[model samples]
Target: WDLVCDSQSLTSVAKFVFMAGMMVGGILGGHLSDRFGRRFMLRWCYLQVAIVGTCAALAPTFLVYCSLRFLSGIAAMNLITNTIMLIAEWATHRFQAMGITLGMCTSGIAFMTLAGLAFAIRDWHILQLVVSVPHFVIFLTSSWLLESARWLIINNKPEEGLKELRKAAHRSGMKNARDTLTLEILQSTMKKELEAAQKKKPPCELLHMPNICKRISLLSFTRFANFMAYFGLNLNVQHLGNNVFLLQTLFGAVILLANCVVPWALKYMKHRASQMLLMFLLAICLLAIVLVLQEVQMLREVLATLGLGASSLANTLAFAHGNEVIPTIIRARAMRINATFANTAGALAPLMIILSVYSPPLPWIIYGVFPFISGFAFLLLPETRNKPLLDTIQDEKNERKDSREPKQEGPSMKVTQF
Candidate 1:
């Protein structure tokens, strides 16, 4: 990268250009995904990522590299969010949360693999080529990707929706049921879906409800804290000690380990509670680093690793929780809104590290405060464990009402495993 730009300041800002693009992509790509189809948008996004990311590796000028990087960032963010949404829409309600959690875990593993590859290759251009290669894999596999049936049904393409549903039924080995399923039944279902969509207000109107307003504000803040802490700690790998590659490898390992444990935590706790716990733990780890004496450098390294683990866990929880809380109709848009804020904070994290030059503990203290205060934000969120995905504002209202209502005890009680 220095080959392209000799100015330290230009090079420094170049690091954030990708995230700035993500911020723009989250809004623009998100709206486009909602307006277009998920599979359609995903295919194009992956194609963009493959072409633009590869081109970025070969750019002659720093300006050209940054430009391609920005376009790649937009494609990357859209691919991630849309794919998650696509899977969530495809899976049954019983498995939706778990599917999202597993998807997040896979993402962590991919990052760790990338880090290991970078460590081995050591050439920036070669490493860039290696990383960009996976986008082509996504493009190849996208042919088998199904258009979201819910989106199809809601958008007045009931025949296409029913076809997808039938394919799903066949894959699930419900051949007998598939034979019995008729267009009339699907048409009736579509009618109800259309009526519900009509009854619901625009997604933007969700902010009007005081409870929802507060919840969005808090959740968005948590996302901000999640990214700030995540990128901040990752950026500080060199400051931890010598052997930058070793430190990064260890950081990736910590993240992979944390992702593995997140599913168990989600199983035992509400998503809201899990997020708060992870954030609080992250805060403790960061504060430990700040309070430790410089002479005890070893202890600070351990604290940093733990902090990275906590941040990774918090990120996974945030993604799963976000999918559950948002309605299907505008989920892509809502996720983009969250991503815009999160990536903005991420873009600022490197600058926070630069602040450490003036004061040794300044960056740690600033980063620590974000997640520490963010835990309280979860208090405003409702638990979505074992609940159906809310498709409309009315569904959310009814879900709250249902939760508030008392349960009647019966002779034969059934327990659910989330």
Candidate 2:
């Protein structure tokens, strides 16, 4: 209970344990969601978080607190993974970026809310309970949420898929849905996808295919670097300002603004380009923090805030791009693989902060370099802007082939050339 001067390291240990739990959750949740349905997993995770997170608040001892937190971490990761999948599945390509961005913006809102709550409530247990209780509402309402039609069809439940589609169409005021939307039409529409889904692929299939393996490997590394830099800077924020609450609010505000701008920015730039640009910007900011004289407190704080915002934007891009590029059949598994890398870096970020005691610039230097490397690595992956989501490995192959084929000259162009 006494996490004071002698036991301060226990705080870091608790964080590390929580990240470890998330890492495990990413793996377990991904497999389960892919095996079950996104709606079911989402509801279960909400309930788990509600119960486990509330218990964490009332823990009797530090050990009990950490254990509950670990369980809560698992639910939290599952919540994130499934929520993103659900959002991607529901939103059309035209609105997918905006949908995911809006979902992610809630984190920024939560951060600001936490800053306010932590300021208003001095008791840590009360703050924890306050946040945990809301999930109960979410879990109760989750029953009304529709299961993903894509998941239904791909999993060989065409009738259920058709029923869900009709419900959606009816909700959208499409009167013809009852007469027009039939099981045969649904099967014909997704015939290629349904056929491809028949062969169940393991997670290892990601590594076995050269193109997918390369993309996954690079994506995993990018996630690792982004999270390490992001969390390292976050953990080091205490040194940047005297008012933790004020600093936290500013951080959240900047992230919210950055996410709000992303949907607009994606309109002009490809996801790969935006990610590279942000990663480079993040690297420059981290490096600048080391170069800036410690006497100039204002400049350092500005750089740190900008760096955090850049990292947040880059993270959003990575998530959106991954979902877009990865085939639906193995998308959850690929996300799990990347999240494992991210949570691993997240676990070590606290340890990197510890290095600041021995050498001030050492942590920032390491953080600065990883993003710089990953920025270029992003160039290796294909651009997914304006592309339809691929449902199977064969779909990905066909897309790649289409992309590679040279465009034939139009009649107008031929006449002009003649």
Candidate 3:
């Protein structure tokens, strides 16, 4: 990097620019994917990410490197957000069935694999090549990627939507799926649903309808807090005075444990409870580290790893809670907006490291404060466990109202089925 950029400070500034690009990409990707169809925009995201990421690895000049990094940041976030949206849309039930433990264990395995790879491949250039080139393989299976069926149906392309559903059904081994999910049946169902929704309120107008706007505004702050603590602890991992690889591995293991613990808690508690608990734990870990390090010097690494773990758990809870809190109609837009704020906070977290020059504890102290306040923010959210996924703003409002009413036991209480 020094050979490429002569100024050390300018290199640091490059990280900020890269984060700016991510913020832009997240919003752009969400909007464009909604307009153009997920599969269509995803192809472009993949192609651009592969090309730009490779170019960034080979950038000969600092300006060129920074430019490529910015573009790569854009491509990376676009790809990430779109892929997540696609997966959430398609794999909601599968993911829920697998539970948090299996999912996080899988993530831990991926992290361990990357760590082992990085350990073996010490050369920066080779590591970059190893990472960048393999991404092109996405194109090989691109043909199998499906356009989002909900996007198709909402955009008045129900025929295309039906075809995709048929393909999905076939994949799930439903022999008579085509006959079962006919275009006529789908159109009738959608027409009835749309008419019911239209009887209450317009989708766009609901954004300004008091409760909904407040939810969005509060969620944005919660997301910002989440990413702030998550990435802050992540960025500070290198400063803990230990072997970097060992620290990272331990952090991964801690995250794996949290993942397992979260699922068990979620089984008995609400998402709001899990989210608040994780945030409180994150705050405790961060503050405890600062206090403990003053007395027990040998415990810094472990406490720091626990802080990262707590933040990781809180991050996952935030994602699940956000999806459940927001109605489906504006989910994409809401998530994109949240991603913009989160990425912005993530970009800013690294700057905290720079602040350590003034006082070593200043950065960690600030990081600890974010989750401390954010834990209370969880009170604003409604519990979503075992509830139907909200399809419209009115549905969310009704749910809020229903929560305030007395509960009826057994079959007397109605359950809305999707």
Candidate 4:
């Protein structure tokens, strides 16, 4: 690539076209996930990776490799989107932060798994094959998976929705309003209550709450900035050298391992505190990029490895945090928009690599501000600690209201888990 670029041949504009493709693909996937349901998109993602990854792995030419890799990027963000909405809606509120954090941690674990694999595999093509197979099986089981209950209820499918809710609660061992234990009873109650509510007035007017647009804008912008920094790090992985593949696999293993473990930690740490802490960690990680390039002579790879893992965890949790706060009726819409901007950020990340042609730190300096400030800003945000995934976008709007008046006057708001 440097050889081609140095000859006044390859241009930043050309490099960024791939990024643009990735961004467009992620936005498209977000909309598709909302329209079809999370499991559908997630299941399809494995198939996509299998096909495109195979093609790229075998490609003998640069053009084929670049094109196939671009296509792979399209399939890339599905795990992020579906997992956020899934765990946010399905996880017990008391453990939602831990759930999302642990979910995010899967990236770490996958990294560790691969580091071990690299000792044996020694080839990117073979490693891709090893990694892609199990995910395909996981995708198949996704066929029997349940859609999100919070999404269903908010979308007004309270009957089928409540059934799924009861199932989730049972699995989580959560006790709720007695009706929540039985779908038949919950639906019967909702059917009568909704009918009665409708007799007086419509349940949800599209325009009843207008601030939704503003909230989406905020969520989208935050996601865009956050992901730009996040993906920029990923995009530049090759800059760390030929051994970067092993480094990345190791990073994924760590993330996946964290996904396996952090749930226990979240059981104790508050959601808001965890998010702020992760954001601060991400900032420090980004800052360390400079130190790795400077002071850490032998440990640069180690520093970058930790930085990558930290960035991924923070990037994921931030999305989980944003998704939970959005009103439910428009949850999909809001998430799509958030994902769109994040993809847009991703599209711009490779551009930062192109800009590295001018000055290496220029991109890092500009990108680093995002995670650093996001942490500070998040510290000022409301605590979603122990808050159950909400039932509806309307429910989110009225979150300040009591489930069934806010002022019960307790030491902490005893948020219900569903």
Which one wins on lDDT?
Answer: 2
Error of 4 at 332 (Å): 2.8
| TM-score list, all predictions | 0.84, 0.87, 0.84, 0.67
lDDT of 1 by residue, 44-144 (tens): 99889899988988999989998998898788888887888898889888987678777776765775676688779988898898888788997998797
For lDDT, candidate 2 versus 4, the one ahead is 2
Candidate 4 accuracy as lDDT = 0.65
Off by over 4 Å in 4: 1-22, 34-40, 79-103, 115-215, 240-246, 253-277, 291-295, 386-418
Best by TM-score: 2
The whole-model lDDT of each prediction reads: 0.80, 0.86, 0.75, 0.65
CA error at residue 299 for candidate 1, angstroms: 3.3
lDDT of 3 by residue, 1-418 (tens): 6634345446446776787688778868776876898888777777787787788778888788788878878887777666666676667675843443464566666666666777889886677778777768886679798887877887778889999989988998999997799888888877854554345345577457777677777778877887877777665565674566676677778777777776666567788877788788888877777676554645877777777777777776677678888888777667777788898898887777666667878878888898889889889877788878888878987887888898767875667784
What is the clash count for each candidate, in the order shown?
Answer: 0, 0, 0, 30
Residue 210: error of model 4 in Å?
Answer: 6.6
Which residue pairs show backbone clashes in model 1? none
Which scores better on TM-score, 1 or 2?
2
Sort the predicted structures by lDDT, highest score first: 2, 1, 3, 4
When 2 and 3 are scored with lDDT, the better candidate is 2
